[model samples]
Target: MNVWREDLLTRLSAAHSATEVFSVIEREGKALGFDHLAYGVRFRYPLSNPRIVLLNNYPEQWQTLYAERGYVKIDPIVMRGMVSQIPIVWSEHYSRASNTFWEEARQFGIAHGWSQSATDCRGLQSLVSFVRGAEYLGSAELTANGARLSFLAHAGHEYMCHQLARDHHAQDSGELTTREIEVLRWTAEGKTAGEISILMGISDRTVNFHAANAMAKLNCANKTATAVKAAILGLLD
Candidate 1:
């Protein structure tokens, strides 16, 4: 990596707070030819209601307008990002479905930009968008910086997730033992205690014991939830 990119990643990894992290991203983004930066994370568990957090250096007036209009739900670039990892270049073509929204964004000086996304095993997804008002986002620019930009997105996501987890106390969480991990791993594969016991050469009672302990540590209500959470958190890996 070039010194510029390498130093940015290093600084991002060591940032002490959300503000500090975004500050670094903003400074580096400007150096890379962008005028504004935004990062957003969506926690997608609890299917009934997912939560989202957005941090940006967007103009306050534009931010208020966006929220008041409930634009996130109607933003096509954001919608496409939910299912695909491809970097999206903001343009009339991609935002055709949300033409009005696109025009509004342009009026606020959101003229040209591109976004990159990163998804974690825990079903938490994040997008990093670097935008500027002037110069078109040419293919040559994307061709040159795509990989580094992708890396920047993921590095930002990693630190944000870690910081958020730490800020929210785990409530005295304990590490799952090797046996507990084995049971949860199999449980995540949709195996019952009886099946797990036979496969691991243990009693069904022992399998249930491990699963229950894991559930307590993970604060899940049942074996299934425990397994799912553990696997998603990469405890199994």
Candidate 2:
């Protein structure tokens, strides 16, 4: 492996949690001439609503503002990455149609950024972005470093997905029983407790019992969320 690849693997091997992984990414981003980094993972399934996580070392005020204003819902970079795997370099024109999203980001010192995305076999999509203060990212720079930047995105994404897979396996082993999975799968298939009970040859009360147990174990808000979470984690597969 080259130096960047070797360094990334070494750091990821030492990372035990998402926070640690983000820290490693932050260091790597800085070394690659960035001051801030943002990483997000989106899990597939439940085509209507998927699970997502965002990690960043952005200013606290900006983080709060972004959430309160729901900037993510309209972020051009995020919207583009959802359908395209191409790397994006932020530009004024990119946000021209959006409602001052880029301007607001600049106010928070998040100007001049690049973003790239990658997807894994498990249907996990990862988008990694790096931002710096002043220097413009011209074409020549992109020609020279775009591949490395793309590699960085992939590296961080794959490492996080690996961690997620491990956590899911551990969670499945401890939290979800076979019966619970059966109930959840049926629930995901749009079956009510009554219908599931009839199909499974169990009492309605017993069906609800398993569903409730699964919900509690999965720490879900409702049966729907529990079913979706299980499917996204590949526990249903």
Candidate 3:
């Protein structure tokens, strides 16, 4: 194992906040010869709107343009990285890449890039990218950096998800009581409050009471979201 990589992983895993994690990653990316670093995590639930969390150090203009133009929908690295199990050296010259998007990105000083994605235990997918304005990556360069980049992608994803999970847990406001957890767990099984009441030998009003309390503690809008949030946070386990 590389000493630098061991130190990097230690620092990342020890990070106390998302900002600290990104700081370590940005500095490491620069040390690795890239001028910019980016990472994104796509949440696992809510199939209609799987939330995306993105962090990047790209130029401000590029960030604005990318968001306004919705370039994520056409980004080749993100597209392939989400499904690929290896580090991918992506370029603007790829056949299927959006020429307009790449042209705009280049004008803003984002050219050469490499990316890889990793999936967490909960099926969440996260990707890390290293980008620079110059120095195209040749086959030799790719070979030299492939393993390290893969390590960075996976290690970065792990700690990023760690910080994210911490944030989620923090937002829970308070711990769920035993009855509240049991109610939510049953609700997660697609059981209606009435059914859960019958199953638990409790009255319908008492079931609703527990579910409502769980929702409040979890900071969720309603019983369904409360149940799902509890399950995601492993509170139901």
TM-score of each: 0.75, 0.76, 0.90
Model 2 ranges off by over 4 Å? 44-51, 92-95, 162-173, 182-212, 219-228
lDDT of each structure? 0.80, 0.83, 0.83
- Which pairs of residues collide in model 2? none
Query: Please, what are the lDDT tens digits per residue for candidate 3 over residues 1-237?
Result: 589888998899789987789899888788779999998888755546886788888899999988898887888887887677677777643656777888888887788888888997777788888999899988897888777778788888888887876775576759889999899888888999889999999999999999888878877789989888778767877
Model 2: per-residue Cα lDDT at residue 168: 45
Candidates by TM-score, descending order: 3, 2, 1
How high a TM-score does candidate 3 get? 0.90
Q: Which 10-residue window in model 1 sums to the lowest lDDT? A: 164-173
Query: Higher TM-score: candidate 2 or 3?
Result: 3
- Candidate number that wins on lDDT, 1 or 2: 2
- Where model 3 places Cα greater than 4 Å from the true spot, the runs are 45-47
C-alpha RMSD of each candidate structure in angstroms: 3.7, 3.9, 2.1
Write one digit per residue (lDDT tens) for candidate 2, span 89-182: 8873464446587777878888898998898878899889999867988999888888888877888898887776576446445567888899
- Best candidate per TM-score, number? 3
